[model samples]
Target: MPMEKTEKTLLSKKELLEIFVNHRVDSPFPGDWESVFKGLGYEFWALRELEPTDSFKNIDWKAKARTGKFFVRDFLAESYFNVMILYDVSRSVQFGRKELLQAHIAVSLAYSAIASNDGCGLILFADDIVKYIPPRMGRTHFMEILDAIVHAEPVRCGGTSLGPALTKLLNEVPESLTFILSDFLYPLDFGYTFHHAAQGSTKHEVKALQVLEECEIALPPGTKGILPLYDYESGRTVSLDLTKWQAFNDTMSRQREGTRTLLGRAGIDLLTVSPADDFGRKINSFMRRPPSTY
Candidate 1:
């Protein structure tokens, strides 16, 4: 049965902001906060003796209590991170009504980063880039990001080229951390793109959020139907023969594996989310997971 869309099923921007803030503050992060920041290229400096006029918040109470010495924590000058959200607005993303969830995830991440004082940017694309918002900080900039996602529409082209968009990103924001949200149904060679982005002077951190439907994996038992299967982008349609469904299933499996292999080889983190899952909790855990060398 197809899931029914509801007001409660989709979150408002206010709710999304609340969830992200709560997760960052109340939920347990996979590792220490300092470690998480460091993994994202944040710099940390050593602690020094506390000055008499230093704020109490900066003083080390334990060190002061242990000895007669007052200690204060010091840190390197922190710069706002360039967080770019690369969303694939291709027609395939609408499958199983997953577009709302995708949008929610994208907005949630962008909001969370902006709340952390990071400059957030957005790129919505299909065959070509539809919209590009350069990274910036402030409430007005964050609201523009929300508006961009809410008003986005996919292009009617028959193909998607992630390479070109990624190329543009490197040229524009070389030291960015890019989050790519897509179904990755394109036939183009993205492995090469991933390889290039992960290497050289303009190296940027890439993470993938794959949106998929359950029907793509398995059909219900005793299912009897002849459905018109269509590739929204390519405009290719075929009759799905229930008796020969294994062929279709095999193809989807291969595509999933191929996407995973390409990202894994490039040391990119990939997280798959389905509409049926608890999206907020699932995404929070993913964002909070301990970073690996991969």
Candidate 2:
């Protein structure tokens, strides 16, 4: 039997959505949310919330006894922080104008979060911070987030610069459950940014949900022509020999692999999402990976 890898068959949005709705992650992450998130694999997520007492922060309301030492309390029977998703609306992610798909995934995350009684929000970025939706736990709130994403205009000013945005978003989410949905194909120093977020984190568990496309992972078998590629950021156009398609493919593969490795090292959960299959199933599967031992 052949491996059932998800392939991009000739299916319209409606057709693929039908398959997704019929199968895939069963949650209140909204109908379209599941489909979009499946394309990015940011469907289900939970976080260990740190309350005022459990956060190891020293607070002396009375200011008496001169006890100025931080204390680390136990769970104290507190509630868990649900989910929040940060979609990558950056330029590099717009390859073939697919960032629109990522936008849909962001909405799905919001719906899922609200459905789970968790707070959901958005962090849209391109080169710099574009928008930030504060996490709120409510069905209606999730709907608003979805509406915002759906009606968003494309950021014609393209290119991805993840480091700055990651740093800012980490601050916003604090220690909440953050799922970064992005292609992250930028030539920036994201390692330091992620490292800082991890080391300086005081409130949330962050996960890296990488959205990948089939065409990006492997190129079609065509080589032997002039290929002109334009940089969305610099507006610089460069022409390359199509004969080097094999090398180009290899480079892309390496870049993606390297990103996963770097994210893993930063204590971030890495889930691969594809644009070629039932996004809901893929998202549900990825979120539920490495079965819990508890």
On lDDT, the candidate that comes out on top is 1
lDDT measured at residue 274 in model 2 versus the true structure, 0 to 100: 68
Give TM-scores for every candidate, taking all chains together and pairing residue i with residue i: 0.71, 0.65
Candidates' C-alpha lDDT: 0.67, 0.57
* Decoy 2 TM-score against native: 0.65
Deviation in Å, model 1, residue 185 alpha carbon? 1.1
Cα deviation of 203 in candidate 1 (Å)?
A: 3.9
Compared with the true structure, what per-residue lDDT tens digits does model 1 show for residues 1-294?
A: 022223357665455555544554432211122222233443546566865434567677887888878886655324667778998888887676567777776776666666667788998888777889999986678778877887677677868878767766877886677888887777644544444444777757777888777677666655677899888877899888776667777778888878777776766667777767665555544544443233
In model 1, the worst 10-residue window by lDDT is 27-36
Task: Pull out the clashing pairs in model 2.
Answer: 29-112, 33-108, 38-279, 91-159, 175-203, 175-204, 176-204, 224-242, 224-243
Top-TM-score candidate index: 1
**For model 1, what is the C-alpha lDDT against the true structure?**
0.67
